[model samples]
Target chain A: MPGQRQSQPLLALRGVSKRFSAVQALVDIELEIRAGEVVALVGDNAAGKSTLVKVISGVGPPDKGVIEWQGAPVQIRRPQDARLLGIATVYQDLAMCENLDVVANLFLGREIHRFGVLDEVEMERRTRELLHTLSIRIPDVRMPLAGLSGGQRQVVAIIRSFLGSPRLLLLDEPTASLGIQQTNQLLDLIEELRDQGLGVLLISHNMSDIKAVADRVAVLRLGRNNGLFDVNTTSQEQIISSITGAADHAVAHRPHPEEVWP
Target chain B: MTNPLPTKARVAEYAGGVRRRVREGGLGPAPVLLALAVTWVVFQSLNDKFLSPRNLSVLSVDIVGTGMVAVGIVFVLLIGEIDLSVGSLAGLAGAVFAALHVNVGMTEWLAVVVAVVCGTAIGALHGFLFAKFGVPAFVVTLAGLLTWSGLMIYLLGPDSSISFSEDGLVASLTSRYYSAPGFTYGLAALCTAAYLLVSLRDRARRAGAGMPCRARSGIWVRTGLLAAVAFTTVAVLGHFEGLPLALLIFLGFIVASDLLLRRTPYGRQVLALGGGVEAARRAGVDVTRVRVSVFMIAGTLAAVGGLFVASRFTSASQVSGSGMLLINAVAAAVIGGTSLFGGRGSTWSALLGVLIIQSIASGMALLGVETAVQFMITGGVLITAVIFDSLARRTAASRVRT
Candidate 1:
């Protein structure tokens, strides 16, 4: 499955399996996210895309298989553990204090402090620098997150995660509820992240999104991976078939997902 | 470029041409003190004792109980919460103190320790429910208000109750009057030194940390002005009496509350949570813990305030805290500058607001103002404060482009 691997393939998931009670959520899923690449994990609802993300980002434990980072196997037990590995998550629901200003939200848990005192000036300065770095233009940094539009809050959330200089970013429905402009903005942001040499695991139901920015596409049909294809080489029809359990669905060694999941 | 002056002179002049505005803004504490001065002139012109040292010291004493309560409330309010039970909680602490002394044969000092511990325990209980179970603070503390008051009343049976006499230690806290001028002068010096030390240390630390620093001249000017104000206040008090212990306690509460809210990470977390709990949690803040701790701090402060109330009257009664203690605490916090909606405030505002309120009350009492009229005046003032606060919040938010 390794085809001219990058200088340092950032993340590799091998035979990763997870089960929820009686249902197999993920089954021996093999995937790789390369540095400076946007990998699309596309599937329908309950295709185990979310479960895969939870495992990679330390939200859930994979009962089977290994998660390797730069050739070494590691177990991510919590969100903090994932973060320490330089992985940031952007969930679908906005995880921010709606009432606080932008600066306050960006520095909520990890605040600047001096001699046991809050370093307001340093925080304010760093906030300006981070915003400037992201090129996310806002007239002021003191407004509440609630006051921002949904798309704008998404942008803030993106900026916040990247502020820690994350190695991998897992985005869940980055633009599910966004409008045309917001979607475009998010797409642009995704491209921007790849340009910054980040390994992005974009979990999107949007067909066009998977087609647009994804360097590699991994489709999961029920717990099993249907097929992993380079987006540049694979057609939308092939991906659609693989996702809906058409290709490699029933071939004994690669049985149809309906047999395993339905 | 052509000025052949000494290195120091050129350094001062090359980049810094002819100085125009040396400082900007009216300065912190200036506006509040100015308002106080203007009020004094208006009230003094209306009545003779309005500006008298005797009435002024009494006014200072009047603020201690409510002042301490307001100070603690400032913490809770900063994190965007409240404690409705503080008045009664304080009363309950007092009853506990009395029972410990009279029934358990404990020393008075030992009873005081038990009282504080009992108050702290109550706060912890409130915190546990609010923090762990996600119970609303208003409801828990409201329940606290009722339950604690009932407990206090039950504890204060008609026959078994203890009372402090005119010369008792507790009674002396409020009644003792300093006739000499030294205490007032000493208070003035202490206040000025405290202001200078705090501001200078904060400024230096910030500068060392590669952050903004206040202008040296600005610091000096502000400190000088405060020193002047403090001295003036003492001089006025010197005319009849020195300083009251209540005033010191009130000031102490203000300073402590200010440090807690403005400097502590706990304060920052509280504000963040008040601003947005989900956001705080995502940011890795132990949101539940902060929420509970704030309420506990508020409860403890309320109990502290109750002790002051008990000391002032030298007795704890069912009707002791029945009037406007809760209202006054809220009024003080709001009037000083804290927002009711949470996320933006300071403890100093609470102190300033209390001073302003007590000043008005004292002025009213001096002129023998009618009770109904006084209530109307206080109500009117509170309304103005609310209007100011809401306006300030709007303006503050307006400047931000989120």
Candidate 2:
């Protein structure tokens, strides 16, 4: 199945490093996402998962890195540059205008216009069609985003990212605030997207979500890559241990709490 | 989404939609309209002359100066920012025009252009400081308010007042009127026709796109209501000196501004920035450019408004854009239902808001009320409008939580 994808990765980051003032957010980060694959990024609270996503999404450029899109190195200095390079990102906050209606938010920076006048009809039609295809239910396209649930807003944000026909998707904690059912729905949608030959880089804390959908899991610890493992072959314990740096800790020899108590 | 519904069901849905919107605090212009109607009634009961044709005509003209400035304020406020400098900017622009045209002997048109350009440039400066330098909008404009007013006072010099020719372009703005019955009536008819045509075309396009469209009967009812308002206003003005050119020009600006904000991508960017600056930035919107341009619009309109004020009195003076003018313009925008928090407003809010303010002022003056009383009353009204805005925002926030 992996061989079916192109030989070159859809996106590859080599030796990416970023620092803010005295704090290093990321260091020597190496990662790859190929078409038709879901790469789950997992880490402890302060790990560089979000920083890496930001670098890829062009919210922040890496201080030292070679980011290759397809097979060619590219510079993504701004969000527009990333967008033009067919990379879409859904930030943890959703990055949506709550005051705007669903249709308006869906077509914010990329509005369909004729002679500078917005074509509301066309945009509305397209929004409805896209939502229908995704089987996402929105009460009304004209309903302001303030009236939407967290899950609905997240879905809308995802739909907005799709508007650019992006080749690679970067989702930063997409299900952080969603309910169980909504999370399930989102996970299913992610799987569907992956099947359509799009590469997905998912940042998540939920181990069950990674187990359920991720093709591979990448663990980060203290601003550095700790380990990467195939979801099918690796145990959740191993990934969690890597995330917490438990295997390398001096306390690794300590007996488990369950074993000691029992 | 486009399934057809019976008329009864459709009407019920429409009513429910309106109810939900109101509950969610999407009040739009309904509250302001009600307040306007109530104001008219209260004033009319106090002085029958308040509703008289002559007074209404004067009121129409009176709204133009402050109305234009208020319209500019709407742009700044839509981005969740305030410009305290607008009053001073207006005064400075008028002083510039007066100085160049009257004292320097510059061509009238050239002077007007230079004055307006000066305003635009000043606004760009304000925008630059706020957007690029990370200064708070309130602070930047507060500093501007003092600086520009000082400049105006300095420009006026010891004389402090300059009267221009009555028949000049500036003075003619207020002095001239389309008193001819045919012209006023024709304009009203033309506006109605244009509105009707636009609505029908929108409906047709929506239907063709397989989207739900407004019912034909609904469109007709709306068009009829608009025509009624337009014709009645024209008839009232026609009875007493017809429509003032200042009023006409003000309305034109309002319509153009409304279209620009509602139909253009640039307008959407402004609204997006107002909604959430961080979100707008992430969405690839040029936040700096939009902010700068919005300030420029506010500045340009302020100058235009100042010119109208000068035209009304046929002179520019130290007090031209001073006193209650700044408060009145800001109050008008808020009163007209433009959200102070930004991202939700129309240009018409300025017109409607200024009308309410000017009506109260006009009514009190007619009743021989003291200036202090007028100020207190206007202050009270401004407070109430702000309370409404706060409550509406709270309701909307609560709805989001649910």
Which window of ten consecutive residues has the lowest lDDT sum in model 2 chain A? A253-262
Under the 3 Å rule for N, CA and C atoms, how many clashes does model 1 have? 4
Show the lowest summed lDDT stretch of 10 residues, model 1 chain B: B17-26
Top candidate (TM-score): 2
lDDT by residue (tens digit), candidate 1, B1-402:
112334444334322421311111112344565766777888889998787777777777888888777877777776677888887887787788766676666877777777877777888888788888878889988998899888887888765345655565556667766656666678689889988998888666545544334666778998999999888777766676666766666677677766776567776787776676665665667766787677667767776777678787777665456648888888888877777877766778777878888888888877888878877887887897778667655754454333
DockQ of 1: 0.27
List each candidate's DockQ score: 0.27, 0.61
Interface RMSD of 2: 2.0
Error of 2 at B47 (Å): 1.3
Q: After superposition, how far is residue B44 of candidate 2 from its true place, in Å?
A: 1.3
Give the native contact fraction of candidate 2.
0.66
Tens-place lDDT digits, model 1, residues A42-98? 876788888888788676779999989987999887666787889988776757776
- Pairs of residues clashing in candidate 1: A96-B279, A97-B276, A97-B279, A249-A256
